[model samples]
Target: MTFSAVARSADGDSFGVAVASKFLAVGAAVPAAEAGVGALATQAFANLAYRPEGLSLMRSGIEAAATVNRLVTADAEAQTRQLGVVTASGPGATFTGEECLPWCGGVADDGYAIQGNILTGPEVVEAMQVAWLAGDPATSLARRLLAVLAAGDRAGGDRRGRQSAAVLVVRPGGGYGGTSDVEVDLRVDDDPAPVEGLERLLRLHELYFTRPDPATLLDLTGDLAAEVTERLSRLGHPGEPDAALAAWAGMENLEERLAPGRIDPVVLDLLRKA
Candidate 1:
């Protein structure tokens, strides 16, 4: 019913699954990730059991292949199960039920699981892996995953066609009330440009939800702050130097911040760091 990839980074700091399908709630079902743990994507008559069970198997010191083997063995419909996994340990594995549609295959290596089923072709997953491996290791997993999804789209993804896409990545204490199990969870449902939409959301998360990178920090002092005030003055937020500087210096605090639109302050940060 879908093609999916579950993988970890070369540095093992992130683990994620990027999946696009003609399926609904793909994010809630197909993508399972835990920071400092493991990741998995189960599809093609997917067994939701794979989410928790697979992770449990991994935590118990099972390899991706063996974990998958255990899950499928217990499943009466193993012929219709397609699974891919990457462990926090940087191990990788995949399985495409012999009953899966054409262009179904996967590559598991280097802390990554790249796979797809009922796909445009094997090239989709291959291109995704190549794009990811070529990406900057220090880049956010969301960005790297977005790159792969874009590559998949370019490669003619989802033989049944695309309607939605989702990404899930997590870390310790990353969940809401420590129960949400997400560092980043974005879904684009029923969109003509789901991956692009997801990218926009990811950028927003980076700006507001995630910490500011050192390069993203800028001195909110001096003439640069003045420039920011002058620039934002016309944006209806009151262009007074103090207000603008305050906004730039994060006067409203990070809680009131909005993404990609905080260009004025970011310019100050850029200039300050330069």
Candidate 2:
């Protein structure tokens, strides 16, 4: 009924889970993670308690396999559960219950776990794992996870069908306004094409939440500066161009991309288009 991947960033500063299922709002139930701790996905007959309990065990220095063992041992219906886990320190693990539907299984690697129940075939999970292994480690974890999910879905996702998808990534101070580690948490509760919907939301998340690279900053000066100032004035921002640009970026929740003497070219383009 679901396919999921739990992973930690190459730098070990972040961890997250991405999941999709024929089940409604799969995100609300299947995926869970904590920054600098670990991540887990519980499906088949998902045990809600396994989420917090698994994370707590990992936080207390338990290995990913041991965490799965503990959770399954405590559950009376363990044979019906499918679980995946990735520890912050790089170990990973997965489990598929004997009573799970046909084509149910998993693959675990050094830093990630991919699992699913009632999938099209082992190829669905194989495609996901291959995509994850082939992903550029330097890229954002959310994008990496989403890419693999797209691959899995294209390979004939959930034999039951697609109703929802979600991606969650966490890091220290990764959340908006520096208030949390929920770097990216998106859910398409009942979309017919939930994986595609998740990808769309992820692109928006990158725009609003990611910091611009300094190498891409555009200096405000001469004709460009004048144009920017005029645009700001037209937008009802009456002030020095630099100050107005700063104010505008702040209003758009893009202040982190601001530099004292220049603005991110993308931010300028976004402002121009607005």
Candidate 3:
């Protein structure tokens, strides 16, 4: 009832999973990752234990294929389960049990795995693999994963239909405020178009949580500064423009993009729309 991709960043600093399905809250069941360790997706009678246990194995120096072998070999229900695993190094691995519903299978390469069960056809997994291989390595792992998921979705995802989707990426100090390993974790628990919803949430996440690109910073000056001041005043923040902008950004959870003597284009656009 689901399709997923698990991958490590080209630089080996990140690991992530993106998945969508007709299942309710597929995110809660299918995807898990740990910074500097590995990632996995367990579905089709998914054994939730595979998540933590698989990461622990990878953390202990086990490669992805071996970790998968250990998990499935020990499970009595292995024939009904499907899993995908990828580590920071070594080849990725995917498994589709013989008893899984029709149109179930997977593919894996050195850095990624794509898998699905109860899917529309082999095309779903094939499209995802193509997207992953073609994605620019310079892009964030989260974005690349999402692109793969979207490709699978476009190619006809779960044979049942779409109900939920999620993307999870991890890297050391990659979470908000650098306090955690979760780089991006967004979910659409129940949506008619969950992949598209996930995409919108990712864009918002980048704007609010990521630091502003130095090259895109605009110095506060001339008409731009005057317009910013006017907008702040209208938003009931009539004060030094910079201070008011800071206060407003704090309220909107956009403080990460704040910089002295400059404005992020995203912030400026939000202020204009406000």
Which one wins on lDDT?
A: 3
**Which RMSD does model 3 reach against the true structure?**
1.5
* Deviation (Å) of 184 in candidate 2: 0.5
Give stretches of model 1 more than 4 Å off.
173-181, 224-274
- Candidate 1 clashing pairs, residues 3+ apart or interchain: 3-117, 218-269, 233-239
TM-score (C-alpha) between model 1 and the true structure: 0.81
For TM-score, the strongest prediction is 2
Where does model 2 exceed 4 Å of error?
250-253
**What is the C-alpha lDDT profile of model 1 across 70-147, one tens digit per residue?**
988998888788888988784688888888777788888867777788898878988888887898988777778888
Question: Candidate 2 — which pairs collide?
Answer: none
Q: List, residue by residue over 1-274, the lDDT tens digit for candidate 2.
A: 9999999888888898999999999999999999878999999999989999999999999999999999999988999999999998857999999999979999998999999999999999999999999999999999999998998999998998999999999999999878998899999999899999999999888887788887888888888888889999888887788899888887887776777768788788888898
Angstrom error of the Cα, residue 131, model 3: value is: 0.8
> Each prediction's TM-score against the native?
0.81, 0.96, 0.95
lDDT of 1 at 77: 87
**How many pairs collide in each candidate, listed in order?**
3, 0, 0
